[model samples]
Target: MQVDADSFLSGSSRRWVAHYRKNLDRDWQIPWSSGTALTSGEKQRIAASIAEFQRGEASEAQDYLGKSSAFSTVARDPDFHAASILFVAEENAHAALLLRFMQETAIATRQHSFSDVVFRWLRSIGDLGWSSRVLLIAELIAQDYYPCLRAATNHAALHRICDKIEYDEKAHVRFQTERIARLEAGRSDPAVGLRRGLQSVLLCGAIVVVYLEHRPVLRARLSFGKFATTVLRRNRRAQRAINANRRCM
Candidate 1:
């Protein structure tokens, strides 16, 4: 289920709205009763990683609401504003799901992480376009990160939760990538190229930071090179999607 802009962002957001609405009714039936028995090393590694990710998820979309009106106006998609609201709700849902897992597993959540702080700062300083690029970068990282997290722990509940999060994240990246393409469509080639270049640099730095930060869980399934390659590949696909949309326009 590769999510490109055309299939996702056709004039009306009815499909997008319906998609999120459908997900809201989903029942994951995570086995909360199944206790998570982790090795000391696993616990030590995953606790901070989950906490940081949970915090990051919770903090996202706060500013997105404020900027979405401008997005609707610029993109000329009336439903985009409504769709953006649903997007924010879905993000908050992911945060809640992670928090539930953390609570059941006795993993304490964190207040702040260095990566989260920096990412937040980047989001804060930018307009919707820049902020969305940052958000998409995080989603690309999560595309890999969640799979490693599912494999790192033996907990069925965590696996289920990760599956749900991963599922939603794929759609999120697609939605965001399309939205970004529309936003960048009217910009000069050099401007879009420069932003893409900046995204590449940010993506590289983010990969290194996240890999080190969650090395234990990530190492369970991927080496640094493999992880970096996977995320970079996803980023490239998104870049291609944006470019393709621009060409069509």
Candidate 2:
């Protein structure tokens, strides 16, 4: 089933019941398993922050769709198209899950205004055939970011949700990494090398912008400087891996 933000918030219970029947009642192990642990004010603020983050992610996903259409000239390449579609689907799922969680808890939030611009830029970058690479970077970022945020969140319910999301996100990164490797291996043209280099640069730029957009959330929940340093270090590692693999090919 194609899950998006609207459907996720509106139909989460049914979806979970249908797909994860046994796991439904299991005690959520992440930080926010118990809703009662947080004051009403804390719940409201956390919900607002999550809602804003979802808005940004969803905006970027929409932009990716538009950008994919333009990149369809190269869509004859099955790996490229598949990676693009998968990345969008995963992001959509992330947004939907967050929305559903917020609605279930009755958390109030004011939508942020910057979401549109960020997504537009994301969509423009999507056409560069870098979706897989970007997904890899995003996954790496999430590995650190989610854990840090989870530690900072006092609400048990929120922490549990983040834990579940983090688990799914890790799986996503593994899938995308393999896909990227496959795509890179199948390429033969010297021009493809140059394109890959350019795409890496673009992906780095996109990551920076995403980090900047979420700076407030990071700053409030954890040390923004630490988060930024961690993200950059991971990104550099990924770049090195990509370069090394290309050379081996």
Candidate 3:
């Protein structure tokens, strides 16, 4: 699901649909039989770290999908709705994969988490722009988070699961970024600036909360500073691309 810049920037939901359909074909064939290698302490630590994220990923997005009709004018991509459906399905697939890994490792699933609740609320606000922006933050965080999750484990199944999820998340980021840029294409400069400012604040807040919640997993690969810097850097690049897309429109 690692889309190229040209394809991702093309703003063609047809391409997105094709990409998602093709992505669904990847089995990963995770070796569920490769029993976990984690110790009792490791299981407890990772379960606490990953449960919230798994819950967040599983958060239903029926509202977001329904609200996507608002994108008809701004997006105008004939296949946009189909792509959106596929995208949501892909996310749910990630949740299921995580759940399987968790069951294998004796990690319990979370019914709720504070951050997940807040993020779910943000996406339920009946505004496509806000929803896309909020989702983008989660997707960007996953770029770094999944690798850390993989590194934190020696379990083969977990590694493969992380690899699959990380791949899909990259495409999800691109998909959301494209939509956000398109949605803001004709907005006033000050309006765009204001929203971007708010998005920055939101991103920063989410990073702090996530780092606090999953520092053990993240510390496997990135220090706090490194993690923050990486996510911020990606956000800047995404913002620039958004601006670029707006200009072209």
Number of the top lDDT candidate = 1
- On the 0 to 100 scale, the lDDT of residue 142 in model 3 is 97
C-alpha displacement of 137 in model 2, angstroms?
A: 4.9
Misplaced by over 4 Å in model 2 are 1-37, 59-86, 109-112, 126-128, 132-138, 174-221, 247-249
lDDT of every model, 2 decimals: 0.85, 0.55, 0.84
lDDT of 2 by residue, 54-165 (tens): 6645644555555544544442333344445655655676677677666767755456546445434543564344556655655776766566556545656667667876
Which scores greater on TM-score, model 1 or model 2?
Answer: 1
Model 1 root mean square deviation, Cα atoms: 3.8
Instruction: TM-score each candidate.
Output: 0.91, 0.60, 0.92
Score candidate 3 by lDDT. Answer: 0.84
Per-residue lDDT tens digits of candidate 1, residues 1-249? 224544455553777788888989999888887766666776787998899999998954668778887777765666878888898888888899899878866899898687788888898787888888998999999999999999987888889989999999999998888778876777999999999999999999999999988998899899999999999999999999888867765
Q: Model 3: per-residue lDDT, tens digit, 143-208? A: 999999999878898899899999999888888887887677667999989989999999999999
Candidate 3 global TM-score: 0.92
Could you tell me the lDDT of residue 197 within candidate 3?
Answer: 95
Q: How far is candidate 3 from the true structure (C-alpha RMSD, Å)?
A: 4.2
